[model samples]
Target: AQTVTQSQPEMSVQEAETVTLSCTYDTSENNYYLFWYKQPPSRQMILVIRQEAYKQQNATENRFSVNFQKAAKSFSLKISDSQLGDTAMYFCAFMDLSGTYKYIFGTGTRLKVLA
Candidate 1:
């Protein structure tokens, strides 16, 4: 069984600053994928970034990056140059490629960018 945990329920960041969202998971599977999804008020899950367990380099997409610690089973997201549009509910998710291909997601972390 795999489980994702987001310690902070809510986070606030000043506009133009940077914020990092913590995410930890427990999993026995060796092959899997970790993801950070952003869901705005519209409720659409947008893929922020993803990291494969086998990849040594952390995944990065523009202003979004991930710190993937394979041994510790930790995956955290960093949002740089925060903007008002970045406000949303972020979710940490895990998917085991060797299993049923189901995603176990964290409760969520609500992020707000303040001007």
Candidate 2:
């Protein structure tokens, strides 16, 4: 079984600053995918970023990036130039290729961006 762990229960950042959320996982399978999803107060699960196990290079978005350590099974999200709109509950997710596309998510890390 693959399980994701988020050490931080919550996080806060001043507007325009940067914040990094920590996430680690345990898996026996070598091939799989990792994801970071954001759920705002509206309760919609949105894909923030994704990384493949085979990719040696980390993934980066406009304001989001990931530090993927395949050896340690650690994938963290870094949000730069944060805005108040970025405040949301961040979840770490994992999926395997066993024909079942199910996501095992972390408890969650609520991020509050102070204006």
Candidate 3:
């Protein structure tokens, strides 16, 4: 079983600033994938960054970076140079490699970039 949690229901950041969104997860499986997704008004879920549970190093994609703490089961996303276009609903997701390949998603956090 795997589960994802997004602590903040909403957040706001100034344009060109940096903002971080926290996420946590629990899983009985030994191997899994953690991900952050962004959904703008277009309603398309875009993959921001992803990390393999077995990896000790965090993952980064351009302006998006992740701080993955395996011991604490914590995965947080940091967005640098945030643009107004970055405003959207961010989701934390988990996928297990436990044969079932099940996916569990978080409640999501709505992030706003104010100019």
Candidate 1 residues 1-115, lDDT tens each? Answer: 7889999999999999999999999999888999999999999999999999999999999999999999988899999999999999999999999757899999999999999
Off by over 4 Å in 2: none
TM-score on alpha carbons, each prediction: 0.97, 0.98, 0.96
CA error at residue 73 for candidate 3, angstroms: 0.3
| Lowest summed lDDT window (length 10), candidate 2 | 94-103
Query: What RMSD value applies to candidate 2?
Result: 0.6
* Residue 17, candidate 3: C-alpha displacement in angstroms: 0.8
Q: Which ten residues in a row have the lowest lDDT in candidate 1?
A: 95-104
Error of 1 at 103 (Å): 0.3
**Reference-based lDDT, each prediction:** 0.96, 0.95, 0.93
Q: How many backbone collisions does model 3 have?
A: 0
Against the true structure, candidate 2 has what lDDT?
0.95
What are the per-residue Cα lDDT tens digits for candidate 2 across 53-79?
889999999999999999999999999
Q: Kindly report the root-mean-square deviation of model 3 from the true structure over all alpha carbons.
A: 0.9
- Write out the backbone clash pairs for model 1: none
RMSD vs true structure, all candidates:
0.7, 0.6, 0.9
Local accuracy of candidate 3 as per-residue lDDT tens digits, 40-104: 99999999889998999889899999999998999999999999999999999999887876679
Specify the highest-TM-score model's number. 2
